[model samples]
Target: MTASRARLAGSTALVTGGSDGVGLEIVRMLADAGADVIMPVRNRAKGEAAIERIRETVRDARIVLHDLDLARLDSVDALTAGLREEAAIDICVLNAGVVLLGDRRRHLTADGFELHFQTNFLGHAALIRGILPLLERSRARVVVQTSIAAARARIDWNDLNGARRYSPYRAYAASKLALSLFGLELARRSGRITVNLSHPGVVPGTAIAAPVRALLPQDLVNWAVHRVGNAPATAAQTAFDAATSEADAPVMFAPSGPFGLWGAPVPRAPFRRFLDADAAARVWREVDRLLS
Candidate 1:
């Protein structure tokens, strides 16, 4: 494996969902690269376990864990409130997300929006806004985790909640698409802080997809995902590279192999729909309204 090219000697990073999967890999990479990393996890036990696992490889890795459940707005608020007084984050990776393909039936978060939408898009939006002051203070750049699905996804603005028509794939794709738009819009609005988006391609072994995989045919799941996706560690490189690179705008990064399924990190734009400035503004307004 090629070593990561980015160096972060005096930087501090905040990574969401760093307990497992690609997020975990990013944490390990960031810590290995000499950055002080802060991770917000859903529970203490999992967080501690993750820390232990990382330390096994990085003996002196600087990692701090806090409680954060992105599915709940209150949790997102609580975490940011603490950060405001603690430290200025130099790099923020919004990587926590859920993909529920177990049942196509729609589900709602505590805030009453579609579960995937809230956790993947709305919550991250709130966290970013809440930490905007610190980010600006540090000239921090935001790294948003999107997906290849977003390249083909569309936002049903009229039905943001997926209440009218729902499908797991559609809901997940739409949430990621919304995230891509948020990153693009943030870059357009801010001159001090850079905002970039990355698609990790297909990571078949992610714990995020485990729930859905449980209900599906095991062989079929393995076949379909393994056929096109890389392991979480491999998939994470694109986001890691983008997060630590010198890109100063809203560039989207993805792998550079057959169908963007695997390889080194490369700049790849999403569909024009994701770059719609008006749509991005509309989504930002809607997110603020929802949070309010």
Candidate 2:
């Protein structure tokens, strides 16, 4: 039963940030299920190495890489050009992101926008917009990797690009928060494709844990965190579920453990408060204005 559910057989998927950690795990699982995986990577050599690793174990893992620097909208454009030239995509996973420690200094993206907001959310949003025709062509499912941090943020139209002020962590968290809000709203606006937001519990060994560990004094604090945290491979299972499962769910899946902190893809609806149709509309309007 599980094998059948895992089977992609001939479907095509694009996994951004498929080079390492949680993203690598996801690519492996998808390839094992017979997906022709498209990896849009910042570094081509690193992506080749990751594909080799997957092929070593999964054999015949259909994986291809397209040079994509999500930080650059132009790169995003090039990636779509290459992908459209290939075949229709069945799944587009917006998984690549970075959390630069701007302890006291502010950084910017190639487009001159706040680094985190531009890369983490806006870049992917542009990717989605650019690929809309392809998505419609393939009837694709879009998966946005949102984080638990989103629960701590609300859409801020006034300073979305952090024109007024910026804190590295706030910028990172806000970017992720904005993605979730957009994912929910995007789904509400366009029902032609299924758009889902997911939180892959506390996978402590992953880069997401790096920010938290940076502030800790002891190395043990970091080691202990990964030891007790969710496994990277397991953390991606929910993403796999969202991309493949035919479950009829109204809300996105927040796959964590019993406490919503660690584990597999357990069924979940996002907070009911987030379900307010009006709020979802407002999110769409504000983000559209900010990015426009």
Q: Report per-prediction Cα RMSD to one decimal.
A: 2.6, 2.5
How does each model score on lDDT? 0.84, 0.77
Q: For model 1, what is the error of residue 192's alpha carbon versus the real structure, in angstroms, after optimal superposition?
A: 1.2
**Tens-digit per-residue lDDT, 1-292, candidate 2:** 1366457888999898899988998899889888889998999999999999888878878898889887888898887776667668888888888877535577777788787887888888878877777887787788888777666666556777777777777788888877766676777666567776667877777776776776777777757666566787887887887787675343456555665777667768775545667766776676567557
Q: lDDT at 55 for candidate 2?
A: 81
Worst 10 residues of 1 by lDDT: 1-10
Look at candidate 1 and tell me the lDDT of residue 7. 71
> Candidate 1 residues 188-292, lDDT tens each?
888778887877876767754677567789898978676757777777787788787787667778888888877677988766778789989998898788878
Show where candidate 1 strays beyond 4 Å: 1-6, 207-227
Q: Which candidate is the best by lDDT?
A: 1
Question: What local lDDT does model 2 show for residue 75?
Answer: 90
